[model samples]
Target: MSDKYAVPNKLPAKQVNVMTHRKRRLREEESHHRVKRLNRSFKLRSKKRDYKKPEFFITQYLKAERDSKRMRRVIMKNNFLKGVDDEEPKLLVVMHHRAHRVASKECTLIMNSMGLNRLHNTVLLKNTTESLALLKMIEPYVVYGYPTIQTVRDLIFKHGFLRIKGKRTAINSNKLIEEHLGEHGCICIEDIVHDLFTVSDNFKNVRSLLLPFSLKAPRDGWSKKIGVSYSRGGEYGNRKHEINALIERCL
Candidate 1:
């Protein structure tokens, strides 16, 4: 009875080998699953790192390139169109208002409606009959003129911005212009220049879509007397083509 219970405690060698093999297989399976989990976690971490990469420098470089090309095209176009329309009288007008001095309520209302609520704030508009009437109504508080092609080009290229969702967004890329004004055939800055310069049918849309330009007081400074007309050497009223010189100095 004792032998039956205790003498057979050691198993056969074949049985022992089979048990050892089964334990090794279980350990190998656990190691394989752990390796797979570690690889998946590493891949997820790499994706997050890729998403964090900064694009600021690339954007700035692209902007610089676009500006350079646009400037060259503007220069060529201006050269070709020069002298041909010197006397044709451009309808593209530049306007700025003197807000320091008191103005009549009627004049103030007109100026504000035209978005000339601040001093040295500039706006470009097509010289239509209605616009002419508005200008005359607030003539005493504003200075206006027929800007040259160069003036218009410089203003839009250097200081131009788009009115996007009621915000003043700078014209950094043609992509941005296309995104907003594509339907009007204004997919790039060049299209804007053409529309504004030619006073095309889409001029109203293009002009209205622009943010009002805020310019520095001309480097030459303004006259102390804001009440007099520009022709008489004061700051207010129209200067006609002479406005180009004033804007250039400010630029």
Candidate 2:
């Protein structure tokens, strides 16, 4: 009865070999499945990483903005060159009417670059393509127009200040003018007014000497709504020759 319940001492060699081969095959299959699972997990992790990247539409918008700006610059250059070849450049009186609190950082930087730091501050700029382009960019915040000689002269004599040694100094004497702009042939206030009015070759040098003119609000207050175009019955944007009248009122 004991012998009937007992197992054989050893199995046949072929049987043992077959069992060993089967175990090895099972182990290999398990290892292959494990490797496949790990690969699938890695792929899923990569997919998640890609999803965490910046949105496609946001990148597209940024790319479009960049392209538009580049195209705008090219257009501005062409227009400026054409104007230069056709006729004399005009002087544009650009006035900043808006406050900085509501302005974008880019607009503020453009204003700062043009020396329009304060409200109602006006700068005399050449009607070059670059200037016109910048004006177009900040049109909603500022007003600009062609100024008559009389208007330019009055603005310089009445409200013009000089940026000297990093300080705002009043234009008092030709001697002071000579001290700063002598090399540029602008020895007197008249020279500056002439250069500015005519938009001459020395215009840039003369403009560099003068600070933006600070003017009062129009005497009767703004005739039209603020922040609207002149054509739309507002005081902002290009008022053309009508800017002289506005400057007169402010003065």
How do all models score by TM-score? 0.60, 0.65
lDDT for each candidate structure: 0.73, 0.81
Alpha-carbon shift of residue 236 in model 2 (angstroms): 0.9
- What are the per-residue Cα lDDT tens digits for candidate 1 across 1-251? 67657767689999999999999999999999999999999988777453433585566566546545644554565433323234545564555655553335555566677777777778877665566656655666677887887887888888898889988899999999989889989988888888888888888898778877778877866745766776676876667778888888877
Task: Give a tens-digit lDDT track for model 2, residues 138-198.
Answer: 6777898889999999998899898899999999899999999999888898998888888
* All-Cα superposition RMSD per candidate: 20.6, 19.2
Report the number of the highest-lDDT candidate: 2
Clashing residue pairs in candidate 1 (N, C-alpha, C atoms within 3 angstroms): none
